[model samples]
Target chain A: MEAETFTLILDLMGTFAFALNGGLTAVRAARVDLVGVITLGMITAMGGGILRDMMLNVQPATFQDWRYLAVAAAGAFIAFAFSWVLHRMAIPIEILDAIGLSVFAVAGAIKAMNFGFGPVQSMILGTVTAVGGGTIRDVLILRVPSVLSEGLYAIPAFVGAALTVAALELELNGVAAAILGASVCWLIRVVGVYFKLNAPRPPRVEPGNLQG
Target chain B: MEAETFTLILDLMGTFAFALNGGLTAVRAARVDLVGVITLGMITAMGGGILRDMMLNVQPATFQDWRYLAVAAAGAFIAFAFSWVLHRMAIPIEILDAIGLSVFAVAGAIKAMNFGFGPVQSMILGTVTAVGGGTIRDVLILRVPSVLSEGLYAIPAFVGAALTVAALELELNGVAAAILGASVCWLIRVVGVYFKLNAPRPPRVEPGNLQG
Candidate 1:
């Protein structure tokens, strides 16, 4: 498969995953009606890409292309319709979310490079594309963004973006490169979730134990 | 003053307003450290313009220029240093926020028009530029976005953007047109706050009134 086609397929799948993730979160956390559910889902799926494109000085594909919107809407509606089943399958949702994260990170980085950004910028944008939507969704639902508090979130994304950049520099076949980058990201994320890994936290200070 | 200069001034003021508004909200609502306060402030100040630029398919001015960042940072630091006094002065903050909203609405619309978008697109982007940052800020603090639930948010922005488009069509002086558009929005928002106005809510449903 061509690299462009591969990236599109992975991106669409990632978008679907995030849409479901956002929709389910809204259903579980808020008293919003159907409009809210679909709206949150679309935002979750597309927000990161939109942010990435804006930084890259290009029109967001979400606004320009109808396919992205249609796919995201489908994901939201499906989640809403199957809320009962989804509610009972928390682990599956988490794994799907991880897949979305990895795909977006690699695709976002590739897109940034295509737009002529440097590797550092590509890596940053890749991470942003992976995590940006969830951050926005969390904020809309009035929660501290998990990106700021959660374990091993951005690390996998950065690594995946780096790998993609390296593959491109080496002129590897596009499909294989994308797959390798995404797989590395997916593995790290799955391990993090399964192991309940946490990034380092600030040291705890005991009350009334200030050192002189 | 040239229209360009006027627009720049208004945009800067709007940036400052949002930064202060965001920082003050953080101080009032969250137990975040200083870094949190500053980060929230910058996001609030810049989020709207970034959203607007993304929709317009242009580089976000916030990312391209340092002035916006410097102003937003100053606003955040000032808010942090005087949060105690600000907490006691809620009305002032609200007024400043209204100013920010009006200015950004007009500026964003004008920018869209400059970028060759249609009037409707300009109006939408304008409103997004006005309210987008605050929406992000509200979400970050774990609160329902006031724009969706509260007093006359999108309305004033729409009207302001429409007015700016109308002025441009009529070949009005740019500075005068901008001032007029922003003033109208500011007035409507101020009145809404003072009168405790709200958009229409869904009809109340009685709990436990299940019909067979």
Candidate 2:
């Protein structure tokens, strides 16, 4: 497959993953009606991309492209309908969430680079794109965002973004580059979760009560 | 002053108001370091404008302009330095917040109209611009955003945006029109606070509360 097509597919997959994650979170957060559930789901799916576009001084791709909206809506609807089942499938949800984070980080970085941003800026934007929606989701549900408080979350995204940027710099902007970037991110995230690894915390400060 | 200058002044004032509001909220929310406070303040001040620009498919004005950043940063710094006094000055902070909401709503609507969006779209963008940052701030602090939960918040913004759009439609896009739109929004918001007026809630549902 063409590199662009591959990246696009990954982006769509990530969007679907985030939509499910967001919908499930909404179900857990409140006794919100259908509007609330769908709203939260859409926000979770598209919020990061919107923010990334704003930072890059471009129109949000999700708004311009119908596919993104359709996939996100479908994913959200499915999650909402299967809330009972999803509520009991925490491990699977976590795995999907990690995949979403990995692919989004790489895709966001590549997009930033395509927009002529430098590597550092691209990496930052990539990480933001990966985690921004979940941050927004956590906030809406009245919890401190895991990015700031939790273990090994932002780090994996940063690593993925950096790898993508490095690959582009090495003239490796192909499927191999994308796979390498995403694999590093996903593997680290999964291992981190399995081992309960944490990023360094502040000296002697009590950890936040929220789980990662 | 030229109408453009008048609108610019109001936009800057709104940025300052949101910065203070966001900074103060951060101070109250957690034992965040200085970076956290300033980051939250800037997001609160600029998030609306960024969202507006995205809807209009243009670069955010805040990113292109330095004055907005400076004003927002100053407001945040002041709030951080004087958290004790600001914490006790809740009434004043609220008034400033109302001013911010009104001006942002009007400015956003006008800008969207200038960019050639239809009236309905302009009004929605305007209201989003007014409340978007505060919504982000609330989420960051892990609270349900005031726009979604509180009384008369989104209403004032919508009213201001509608007035601004109406003014443009009536060919009254001048200082008088700007003043009219902003004043109406500010007055209603201040009055809403005084009377404790709430926007219509979903019937009979207990408000989900997390301590402010």
lDDT scores for all predictions? 0.84, 0.83
User: DockQ (Cα-based) per candidate?
Assistant: 0.18, 0.14
- Tens digit of lDDT per residue, candidate 2, span A1-212? 87678768878888998999899888888777788778788888899988898788777889998999999998889888999988888888889889899998988888888887777767878988988888877777766776655567778888989997898899984567778888999999999899988654322212564343
**lDDT of candidate 2 over B138-203, digit per residue (tens):** 778777787888789889889988987888789984566767888999999999999999887676
Q: Tell me how far the alpha carbon of residue B194 in candidate 2 is from the true structure, in angstroms, after superposition.
A: 4.0
Q: For model 2, report the TM-score of its A chain.
A: 0.91
- What CAPRI-style quality would you assign to candidate 2? incorrect
Predicted model 2 interface RMSD: 5.7
Cα TM-score of candidate 2: 0.61
Distance (Å) between predicted and true CA of B201, model 2?
6.2
Report the lDDT tens digits of candidate 1 across residue range B31-120: 888998898899899999987876887678898889999999999988889998888888988898898999999999999889877676
